[model samples]
Target chain A: MSELTYRDALNLALKEEMRRDPSVVVFGEDVALYEGSFKVTRGLLAEFGEERVKDTPISENTIVGVAVGAAMGGLRPVAELMTVNFALLAMDQIVNHMAKVRSMFGGQTHLPMVVRMPGGGGSQLGAQHSQSLESYFMHCPGLRIAYPATPADAKGLLKTAIRDPNPVIFLEHELLYNSKGEVPDDPEFLVPFGKANVVREGSDVTVVAYARMTVLALQAATELAKEGISCEVIDLRTLNPLDVETFVASVRKTGRAVVVEECWRTAGLGGDLAHRIHEACFDTLRAPVRRVAGLDVPMPYSREIEKLCIPRVETIAAAVRDVLAASV
Target chain B: METKLRAVLPDHELVKLYEQMVIGREFEEACAEQYTKGHITGFLHLYSGQEAVAVGATAGLHKDDYILSAYREHAQAIVRGAEPKRVMAELFGKATGLCKGKGGSMHLFAPELSFMGGYAIVGGQLPVACGLAFSAKYRQEDRITACFFGDGAVNQGTFHESLNWARLWELPVLFVCENNFYGIGTEVHRSSALPTVHKRTCGYDIPSEKVDGMDVVAVFKAVKYAAEKVRESGRPYFIEATTYRFRGHSMADPAKYRSAAEHEIWKSRDPIPAFARRLLDEGIAAEEELEAIRKRCTATVQDAVTFAEESPWPEDRQIWEDIYV
Candidate 1:
């Protein structure tokens, strides 16, 4: 294992995939010469040349639509939307064409492509820029969504997404880009979809989260441990092919659960997880399934208020404490 | 370089074009008949009067050249070499359909024929066509992508974006706008600030022109010239084929919005009979031979209907099969 930032891990994944397959191509706004606004595509143009690594116009819909066509024309295109918020502009292509192509065309072709977007609401970018739209993607069928919380999963899941024979939505958190971690040096390492990782195993209560929220959940688990309360933090690596079984098994063992999500409370992924946990571990539960989701409001601009809107370590720990203190 | 009508194409080739047009006409008529008989369902957009645009443009293209079209695409697919029986089966939602009955009428796809697909959304196929051309250029292939859409699609954001990108990338794309005058019920004058579709491409620095969509030879010649220029220059070219549709926008439309005089004027220039008259006047084919070709087209369509009726429905388990690889 080697220490690398989340951004570098993603860059390494792109470089390795491009080197492994000539069919793989990368393009987006300022992805080539600019090395990407986020620098995730740094050195890709130098390594792959302009033929494979391209800088496209700031046309989000066409960017995705072109990727759909390129995938149909036998090229594995990894398109970046700059950010998840801009993906709203390409919703027509994403929802109408990319998601519907294979099924609508009766499986005549496969779209081996990936759409990478950096998303989350913590950097004080305000409502327009700071939005967690994973629920939107999870709501749509014919799409696989991966939001890695660590550098290791970033590299592993990205490589898996590149090799996947269907469209994948790869969400990266802006805050986690600078965070360093020990990532496996193996270029062949792949994180399979539909499997949850129990980050900190415990027997008291199960805490389920993913992406940036997973980091907070881990922190909350550490804090809960100080109070003599053991919390099992299950990091959901993928949203669509959700590893409910892993979390459900954890809920059965712990006899309590709390789902943490960064998106708005209503229609959030946490609600879905809470429902599933209740359904799967009804008899085994000590208290009701709790959901610690972001407040049902657009992300505010001020840091203090924004902190209140998103799920924090304190909020997660409090929810875990509530579930543990509740009478059966 | 204006060749006489007799010399525009050889006798055999001219007759072949006429035969394809007849086949397209007969196939759409059969689809209409099948729709009423309850064999075909869904949004059926017939290409009855706009045959020449699909037939002529497809004939001008090399077999390896890719083709993409909108929902009104049966003629485009058939002309691009998709078997009529399979296309009909797709319309019938049979398991043996071109798309295995997954796409139905508006999404026929034949990858082997390089017929990319039939996009249901207006202007949805433009960027995809650009991407196909980009792939060809990136792989150092000498093929171009022919994208067909209607006048209604010109106002879509994708149309403008695709044209700009295609020109900026110098990709080989032949944008064929079949101006059937209406986007469902909205006429061109009401929908577009500038109703001339070809002129809209001037903003993108892409060269474009207009042709008589009712004349098969005109569309064929214009597309042939434009496609060659696109292939040579590695840039996109636009052609507005001024055509008319005899049928309603869809099976449900009664076409009450159109005036009788406008329909009559367009009907007089019906491509099939007009091309037949030119063929007879030019001594390309005898009356008996032309009549025989029409009968053959009729039989082929009938055979396709029979095949679609005999084809089986897709299994229930297969619904979840193709969403991923």
Candidate 2:
């Protein structure tokens, strides 16, 4: 094992997949000679050549749609959207075409494709650039949504997503791309989808989250540990399949749960998780399933306002503290 | 990749094209009758006069080449080797249909034959076609994807986006635009900033051509050359086949947009009989051979209708299956 940043781990995964499968092609604007918008695809063009690693026009719909068609034609295409914000332009292709092609086409065609987009807020990038759309993809069927919370999860889950025989929406946190952690050096290390990692295990309360929010949830768990609050931090690796069993079991033991999501509060993925928890473990709960999400407004540009808009470690700690105060 | 076409597609090929056009025309008319009898119920866009485009271009490609089209695709499906009974059963929402009755009319998919689908949303199939072409190039397969859409679809963002992407990536996609001069009630001039649809593909740097769609031999020649270039270079090409719909866009349309004189002029350009006349005038097929081809087409369509009528409905539980693996 060696320490690698989230971006490096993702890059390594792409390299490994390309070497492993010749059919795996990567394309995006500025993805080729310029490395990448964030250097995630650095050295790829030099290593793989233009045929496998391509720079596409700045058309989001075409980027996504081409990926879909290429996948249908029998290539494993990994398309990179500049950010999740730009993906809105391709929503018709992504939602109506990618998400429904399998089901609507009567299960004959498998969209074995992957769309990677960086989402979430922290750099004061404002509303247009910083947005979390994992919830939107999770709401759609025929697509697997992966939200890796750590570098290891990033590498392992991305490899799995690329190899899976279905269309997958992989959400990466823009803020965590430079964050470093130990990732396995093994080439065959692939994390299966829908399995949540028990980052911190406790019996008092369950804190379930994914992607960037999971890091905050763990930070909150650490701070709460000082006050004798034992919160089990569950990092949901895959957002769509959703490891409902892991969280449900955690909630059953703790009799309480708090769902954290970086997206807005109303109609967010957290709401769906909360509802699932309430329905599954209603009798086991000592308190209502609490949700900590981003503010229900466009992300603000000011650093301070942006900090307030997205959930923070302190907000999560407060929510956990408030839930524990109910004496579960 | 022969652009001039070999021997102008023997008289038999023209006769076969005439038969297909008649079958497509008769099949669409039957769909209207079935809709009245409550056998088919979704939005049905009939392609009564645009037969030459599908029959001509599809006749130009190899069976292994991939195909995708917009909502008005019953004719394209037939030309691309989809059994009419299965397609009709799919339209009828029966279990034995190509999509097991799930796709209705808009979302027809036949993967084994590489007939991907009939997308309902305007310009929806462009990216999927690009992806398919990309895959063929990635796999080093000598295949191209033929994607079809209407003149109204040219104004859509997917049209421009797909063209740029296919050219930028140099994918083997042959975009076939069936410019019927109308999108529902809106005319080509009304919907597009530039009414010349093939010229619109220039922004993407894709090489495009225009042909008289009423002439099946001309369409066949153009598509064959375009498919060859796409396969040879693993790049994209565009062609706009100028044609018209003889009937209304759908069964409910009264077609209040054009005058009767315009309708009569276009009806005179009806591809089926015109191509048939050319074949006879050129000593390609005798009148009796042409009548035999028409009779065969009518009988084949009748057999398809019987097959659709006998097909059963899909089970209720089937709807819950196949959404995922």
Candidate 3:
């Protein structure tokens, strides 16, 4: 195992995948020479040359549409939208074409491609730049969504997503890029989809989250452990092949749950997760499932107010305590 | 007369082109009849008057070249060797359809035949065509990608974006715009700032031209030359085929917006009869031969309709299938 930052791990994953498969090509706005807005594609153009590592025009919809076409024409294309906020611009291609191509074409074609977008709040990028739209993609069928929190999982899940025969929406958090962790050096190391990682083991309360929220949940779990309130932190690796079984089992054991999401409170993924937990562990639950979600408002530009919109470690801990205190 | 005919193609190939156009017209007419009877449902955009564009363009490109089009693509698919029966069956939503009843009339796909797909969204297929061309260029393959869209699609952002991308990347793609004058109900003059579609490619630095879409030989010659230029230069080319749809945009449209005189003028230039007249005048084929070709085409369309009627419905279990790999 080698210690690597989340960004480095992702860059390594792209390098490894491109080396492993010649058909794997990378392209997006500033992805080639500029190395991507997030630098996840750093050193790709130097290694793969201009033909494979291309910098496309600033056309978000066409970026994804071209990826879909490349995948259909037998090339594995990993396209990047500058950020999740810009993905809304490309929603037509993402939802209408990329997600619908395979099923609408009657299984005759499979799009082996990945669209990477760096998103999540707390950086004070304002309303348009800082938004969590995972639920928007989750609402659509025929797409696999992967949002990894740690370096290891980031590398593993992205490699797996690159090799998967279906179109994958790979979400990366902007703040987590500098965070470091141990990652497997093996090019073959892959984290299978639909399996939630049990980041922390406890029995009092189950904290379910993904991407940047998962990192905060782990921190909250550590802080909760010192307070004699053991919280089991579950990092949902992939949202689509949602490991409802793992979370359900955790809720059954803990008899309480707190779902944390960075997206809006209204119609957030938390609502769906909490509902599923309630349905599966209704008899076993000692308390109604609680949710710590992003404030239902456009993300504010002020750093002070921006911090209040998304879930912090303190907010996660408070939610866990709230769920624990509400025990029947 | 023989010299004029030979300038476009051999007599035998011209005859074959005529047969393909007749098949397209017959299949679309049949689809209209079936739609009226409620056999084929959903948005049915028939390629009735635009037969020459599809048939001629398909003939112009290599068999290995990738072809993608807008919703009015039944003729394009059939011209590219997709079985007419399978395409009709797809419209009928049968299990034996090209897309196994999943993709209806608007989304016919035959990857094996190199007919990529029929996109319902205006200008959606343009970027995809670039991708296919990108793939071909990446693999050092000799094939090119042929993308067909209507005049209405030119107003879409994808049209501009895809054109710029194709030229910037130097990808081998042939963008064919079937300028049928109207986008649904609004005519090109109303919808576009510049109604001249082919002239729009100049902004992207891609050379383009306009062709008389009603003449099969003219479309074939233009597309053939442009496709070869794309192949040899490894760059994009554009052709705006000036044409009109004989019918409404889809089955639901009554086309009350079009004037009788305008419709009559376009109908007078009906490609099938015009080409048949040329063949007769050039002594390429006798009237009896043309009649035989029409009979054969009618039989082929009838066979397609019968196949669609006889085919089974997709099983209930298939709904859960094909969503993922």
Q: lDDT tens string, model 1, B1-325?
A: 5355665678888899999999999999999999999999998999999999998999889999999999999998998889999999999999999999999889999999999999998999999898889888888888999999999999999999999999988899999999999999999999999998889888999999999999999999999999999989999999999999999999999899999999999999999999999888877889999999999999999999999999999999998989977
**Interface RMSD per candidate:** 0.8, 1.0, 0.6
lDDT of 2 by residue, A176-245 (tens): 9998999999999999998899999998999999988889998998898999989999998998787999
DockQ of predicted model 2: 0.78
Q: What's the lDDT of the predicted structure labeled candidate 2?
A: 0.88
C-alpha-based local distance difference test score of model 3: 0.94
Candidate 3 chain A, run of 10 with poorest lDDT: A319-328
* DockQ in order: 0.82, 0.78, 0.84
Q: Give lDDT tens digits, candidate 1, residues A179-200.
A: 8999998889899987989998
Off by over 4 Å in 3: B1-3
**Candidate 3, B261-288: lDDT as tens digits:** 9999999999999999999988999999
Find the candidate with the highest lDDT and give its number: 3
Among residues 3 or more apart in sequence or in different chains, the pairs in candidate 3 whose N, CA or C atoms overlap within 3 Å are none
